[model samples]
Target: MKVSIITVVYNGAEHIRDCIESVLSQTYPDIEYIIIDGKSTDGTVAIVQAYGTKIARFVSEPDKGLYDAMNKGISMATGEVIGLLNADDFYRHDRVITNMVSLIEQTGSDAVYGDMLYVDRDDTQKLKRYWRSGWYSDNAFKWGWMPGHLSFFAKRTLYETCGLFRLDMKSAADYELLLRFIHKHKAKLSYMNEVTIVMRAGGISNSSLKNRLRANREDKLAWELNGLQPYFFTLWLKPLRKIRQYISKPPVKNAHS
Candidate 1:
């Protein structure tokens, strides 16, 4: 099946090449790579332009925000399945997409997600955290468990059915969307059991204590928006879950291995 990988970037010239190259290097033959840039003025557009048509769809324009650009990319995507890769992250290996497609076909699942690693921004080889996403359960969201968004891939029809990311949310939009799809809508999910993406450590939500608190508030709102109630400890457990990831180490063989 053809997969569409979307990368939304803004003023990310320093690492956009790595993100783009990772998609270009995928072992899977049928991939439609789409990049939505937020009118980057820092030469990010030039770097992506250097690749020419290798990138199937490139849009560089001012957007509302991160999730807005992502919504635009999703609208443009035309493939059996779609996945989002951030500008500061890259696929774990050339065959990550291959594995995702294989598992989706095998399990006949609406979505598939695997593990992820958090490495230093300057030195990706230096592992900082290992997010091993275990199997999904019916009450996973109630316990604040979620698969890595970067490693998650879902059928295009799922998006057509459930809807796209909310523009109002600042940080927890991804969590909200996943909660809606997997928990509320009951989308059939499959676990890939491997690291699918290597992400840079500094993310918006975790960059500051204030931002984290804001994200916590938004996370609570995520459940309320869906007309669902999270356990009292749910939002607390969400950030607390990452504490274990920081101490966890990657296995000998992962997607890159």
Candidate 2:
């Protein structure tokens, strides 16, 4: 099955090139690489254009925000399976997408996910945090457990049924979409207990205490909008779950250590 990878970026000159190269390097030859740029003024577009025909579609235009750009990419994706990779993230290896395809096909799963590593922005070789997403269960959502969206791949048709990201949600749209599809709709999903994406430390969701608080409110609203009720301590447990990530580091990637 063909896989479509979408990358939404804005002023990501520092990391966008590597992100593009990673998508192009996927061992799965039938990948349709789509890049959505919010009219980046920092020369991100030039680098994307440099890739030329290697990329399937490159959309450069003004957008409302991150989720809006994501929705646009989803609408344009033509491949059987669709996945998103941010500008500041990259596949753990060239075989990442190939592995994802094999797992999803083997299980006939509508969606599949894996783990991620958060590395130092200045040094990608140093793994700062490890996000190991265990197998999914409806009950886990109540406790605020979620798989890293970076490694989640879903069938394109599923989006039509579960719907796209909510524009009203500033920071929690991805969470809401996953909750809606997997928890509520019970989409067929499989988990690969391996790390496939490495994220650069720091992002809008966790950039500040204030921003995190705002995201919390959005998350709560996500439950409310779906007519679902979370455990009273659900939101509180979410951040607490991430505490271990700050202390537990992964094996260093540097050679000749």
Candidate 3:
């Protein structure tokens, strides 16, 4: 099946090259790679442009915000599966997409996601933390369990059905989207233990304590908006889950396949 991967970037010149190279090197043959840039003045566009015609779609216009740009990419995707990769992140290996697509298709799952590593921004090889996502259950959200958004891949039709990420949310739109899909709509989902994406240390949602609190509010609202109730401690446990990731050792190089 054809898979469309999108990178939503803004002023990411330092990391865009590695992101582009990782996607371009994918062993999966039928892949459509797109970059949705936010009119960066920092020459990030130039680095993406350097790739020339290899990119299927390149949009370098201003958008409302990060999720807005992501929605744009989602609307443009026409492949059977759609995924997002930020400029500061790269796949674990060239066969990452190949393995994910195979598992997702074999199980007839609407979405698939797995583990990821948090690596240093300057040195991608230096691992900071291991985000090993366990299997999903019907009540996984009750315990504040969620798959890494960067590693999440879903069928294009699921977006058409469940709708795109909510723009109203500041940081927790991804969690809300997953809550709607897996918890509300009950999309068939899969979890492979392979370390999929390696992301840099910082991100918008966790940039500050204030941002994290804002994300907490949004996550609480996520369940309420879906007309579902979360456990009283759900929001608290969500952040607590990451503590173990920091304690575990990083996976072996070939553990994925």
Candidate 4:
């Protein structure tokens, strides 16, 4: 089955190539790489144009923000499974997608997920934040557990049945979408129990004190919107979960490393 990997970017010339190459290097032959560029002026378009044929669809136009750009990618995706890869992140290895495909097929699950790693700007592994998304549980959402969006792959039908990212919410749209699909809609899912994506430090959500606060407040809103209690508790649990990540060792990468 084909998996559509969407990379939403705007003026990410410095890191876009790494993200693009990660998808292109996936051992899985059936992959639709979609890049949604927000009318970048910083040579991002030029870089993307260099790999025109390798990319399934490349669009450069002004967008509302990250969430809006993601919505556009979702609308354009033509694959059995849809996964999002930030412009500042890359897959853990060439076989990550291949493994996800095999696991999804073997388990017959509607969605699949794996762990993640956090690296420095130079792509040097700084910390391994293993997202231990264990077996399915209805109460997992209550503990504020979510499959990291970076490594999660959901069937396209889930989006059509539930909905795409909420364009109005800034930082918490991914969290909200996860709540709706995994908790509210209760889509069947599988956890791969392995690292899948590597996120570089200094993402927009953690760029500044103000942005971090906004992300936390928006996270509370996600819990409330999903009709879950423990607003403050969940918010705290979200970041606290990363504490385990700081202790784990980084995985070995191939040439893509």
Cα TM-score per model: 0.96, 0.94, 0.96, 0.90
lDDT for 105 in candidate 4 is: 92
For model 4, how big is the CA root-mean-square deviation? 2.8
Backbone clashes, candidate 1: 0
Runs of candidate 2 exceeding 4 Å displacement:
205-209, 251-257
**For model 2, the run of ten residues with the poorest summed lDDT:** 248-257
* lDDT of model 4, residue 144: 63
Taking the tens digit of each residue's C-alpha lDDT, what string does model 1 give over 174-220?
Answer: 99999999999999999999888999988674657887888888998
Q: What is the C-alpha lDDT of each candidate?
A: 0.92, 0.88, 0.90, 0.83
Error of 4 at 227 (Å): 3.5
RMSD of 1: 1.5
Clashing pairs in 3: none
**Pairs clashing in candidate 1?**
none
Q: How do all the candidates rank in terms of TM-score, highest first?
A: 1, 3, 2, 4
Candidate order by decreasing lDDT:
1, 3, 2, 4
- After superposition on all C-alphas, the RMSD of every candidate to the true structure, in Å, is 1.5, 2.8, 1.4, 2.8
Better of 2 and 4 by lDDT: 2
- Name the runs in model 3 displaced over 4 angstroms: 205-211, 255-257
Q: Model 4 segments beyond 4 Å from truth?
A: 128-132, 205-213, 230-232, 250-257
For candidate 4, write residues 1-257 as lDDT tens digits: 88999999999999999899988988889899999999999999999999969999999999999989988999999999999999989987889888888889999998998877777777455563455555668767767677888788999999899999887677788889988888888888898877788888665545467876888888888777778676447776776666676676645544322
